[model samples]
Target chain A: MAQIRCTDLTLAYDGVTVADGIDFTVNAGDYLCIVGENGSGKSTLVRALLGLKAPTSGSITFGDGLTAKEIGYLPQQTEIQRDFPASVREVVLSGCIGRFGHSLFYTKLQKDLAAYHMERMGIADLAKKCYRELSGGQQQRVRLARALCATGKLLLLDEPTAGLDPIVSRELYSLIEHLHKTEKITVVMVSHDLEAVMHDASHILHLKKKQLFFGTREEYLDSEIGKTFLGGAGNA
Target chain B: MLEMVFEMFTYPFMLRALGVGVLVSLCAALLGVSLVLKRYSMIGDGLSHVGFGALAIAAVANLSPLKVAIPIVVIAAFFLLRLSENSRLKGDSAIAVISTSALALGVLVISVGGGVNTDLNSYMFGSIYAMSGEDVTLSLILSAVVLFLFLLFYTRIFAVTFDESFARASGVRVGLYNMLIAALTAVTIVLGMRMMGAMLISALIIFPALTSMRVFKTFRGVVISSAAVAVICFVVGITLSYLLDAPGGASVVLTNLAAMLLFSLIGMVRKS
Candidate 1:
């Protein structure tokens, strides 16, 4: 069974429809990249998938033991984070907040889990450092480590490389791809970066306020819409 | 100076004011870190205005002010949170509208009930002598509750304040935690109003956090320093106010202002 299935989904807010008739399904170990232009409801879809916003119509169901709470999320950075006073360790440990059902503090096991992910993301040495003091790439790595701590099964990342330069963005993409291959974690990424999407994603779901295409990477490469988008995207 | 401090401590009213002031300041500083970082610093000010309006209504109706004001201010906090989350008028605009309306309502009610008297003056600028034993007891209990809840959910609160979307996705019940912060702020505002006044109570909430943020680079450091700053300022402000015959709330606010400037200076010096 598919890990997540969204059937005929329509998203709207403030009396305005943003996207309509969105349909997709993610099977286990699938590397799905959602590509779209600005205002194409890509963010809206990410929010819906995380169960933060309800769809205006249709349904989203999880199978293969997947639940909304179990999907690790690496959200885009916000203004609040720019000057936030928190250590890398503290921020990463916060990802384990969901595991504390009724406990007031984190357990030893959760701490170890956070530590492991931080080491995996190569940020263990920076654990005691202030998060905001780190460079943009390092900050994203810390966030990614936090996301890994949240869930070991799946990840939902929104524009994870929105700000970094080409070198750092490529490095982050490679890290994500390594996680996908070795850990066998399902990935759902929202991005505008066609280069990374073309190089890494196993499946593509293109959007322009609607589902323009949803198919395998080979199928997408051969499709007319994909060719047009890739050409237009490549020039820019 | 030591003898003067000893003299001030001899009075029963002074003792009560110090006790309540310490607890209220501690609660405000703890919540302030999250509020300041979340850009909801003005929330404390807004809720204090709602508290004032509630106090006015209670005075006119001959009811217990704390009892009446607590629930009204909490409900208003919830309303403000909901408005900011969903309404067209987002955060600061919503807070401004509600705060001004509530302040106006308070003034209107006070004037209709005859005129400004010692009760109004005491509530507006704050008088240490206004800290009745009963008010102290209530403030103690309420502040204990605020502190307990804050510590119990400290990590969750940190998560929600830092990143709401990620916290929500991680199954942290983001809405509940946000409401928890709002409700605690309401209770702290009401409790501090008798000692700090509605006009100046939010200084207790904002100044220490901002001052600590100037020097601290970590959340735990910021939180610990904010609490210490709050307690020291309260003690100093109370002492200065008693000695100089100044309004208690204004004295504290001035003390906080001085600390903020001093910390900013230190931060700049360290950077250079």
Candidate 2:
């Protein structure tokens, strides 16, 4: 059974239709990559998936006992974070905020979860360090650890390596790949890194203001849209 | 200096002002950390301006200023939120427009009604004599409520301030928390405006947070230090006001400015 399924999803904001007729499903443990050009509604689709924005039409449903809150999310860095005053551990612990629901403080279980994720992400040593003082790659690791604290079932990443050196980006990608392979966690990533996507993803969903293609990675490589995107602008 | 300080505390009005000042300073400092982080620092200034307009109306009608200002300022805060979120006005511009208009309306009303009495001057510049016994009690209660709500939602506010999208994705009600911060800010502004003055009340919300951020590397450190900075500044400012017979609000603002400069110097020295 699919962990998440979207049917004929149409997303529009500010009276403008950014994308329409989007249909896809993620089976448990599937590695899905959403790819698109700029202004192609890729981020919008991510928002819709995360339940941050409502679709103008169609339905998104979770199966296999998956709830929306159970999805771990690693969003792109925002301007506020560039100078934010927060310890690494404090940020990671915030991810467990959803687990308890309106509780005043984190429990020992949540703290333990955060600590474990930090250790796994290779950021346990940086736990007491200020977040703003960390390097770009380390900050992403902190955020990835924070996301891991939210859920263990599935992970959604939107441009997780948006602004990092190539070596750092590769390291993050490998770390995510390691988590996916070892933990049996379903992964949905939005990315502009076509080479990485081709190498890492099991499935591809291409968007160009609409659903251009949705299929397995091999199938996507053979599809006309994927061939054009990969052969023309994408690094083949 | 010790005897003079001890003597200043003996007066009932000084004691009342001190009590209200401490609570307001604590509340402002707590909420200020989030507001400054979220870049909503000017909301305090904007709401205080709205409070000024409301106070002008209250004074003209012989009603309690707090009674009239609280709801209006809160509504203005919500309006600022909505305007920034939905309208083309954006954040800082919306604040500028609304706040200036409110300030103008206050000045116009004050000029038209009574030709600028000492009562009106006190609201604009803030005098220690401005706080009455009833006003002190009301201010203390409202300040306590502000402090309580801020503490209750501290974690969520930190999450929201740090990252709104992640907070929303984590199933945190980002909009609801944003509204909570705005409303609490509104109440704090109205409560402090009587003593801090409408023009300078925002200093209470901005200076301590910025000062603390200069030296503190973590949010918890900044928050704790911000509260301490605010209280110490308020105490010193009020003392200077009593000694030099300066305006209470101006004294406090200058003290905060000095603290900010001092912290920045310390931060730079530590870096070197």
Best DockQ among the predictions, by candidate number: 1
Candidate 1 lDDT over B1-272, as tens digits, reads 78988999899999999999999999999999998998888788889988988998888877888889999999999988887767434777988989999989988898798543437877787778778888788778978898788788888888898999888887778888889889988988998897788899999999999999999988989999999999999999989998898888999999999999999999999989
Off by over 4 Å in 2: B86-89, B115-119
Q: Candidate 1, after superposition: displacement of residue A43 in Å?
A: 1.5
Tens digit of per-residue lDDT, candidate 2, span A71-101: 9999889888999999999999999878867
Indicate the fraction of true inter-chain contacts that candidate 2 also forms.
0.77
Task: Report the number of the highest-TM-score candidate.
Answer: 2
Can you write out model 1's per-residue Cα lDDT over A57-152, one digit (the tens) per residue?
999999998888889999999988999999999999999987778887989999999999999999999999999999999999999999998888
- Give a tens-digit lDDT track for model 2, residues B1-272: 78888999999888988888888898889889988997777778888889999999888777877888889988998988776656433777878988899989988888788843437777887767677888778777878787787778888888899988888988888899888878888988887888888889999999999999999999999999999999999999999998888888999999999999999999999999
Clashing pairs in 1: none
- The Cα error of candidate 1 at residue A215, in Å, is 0.4
List pairs with backbone clashes in candidate 2. none
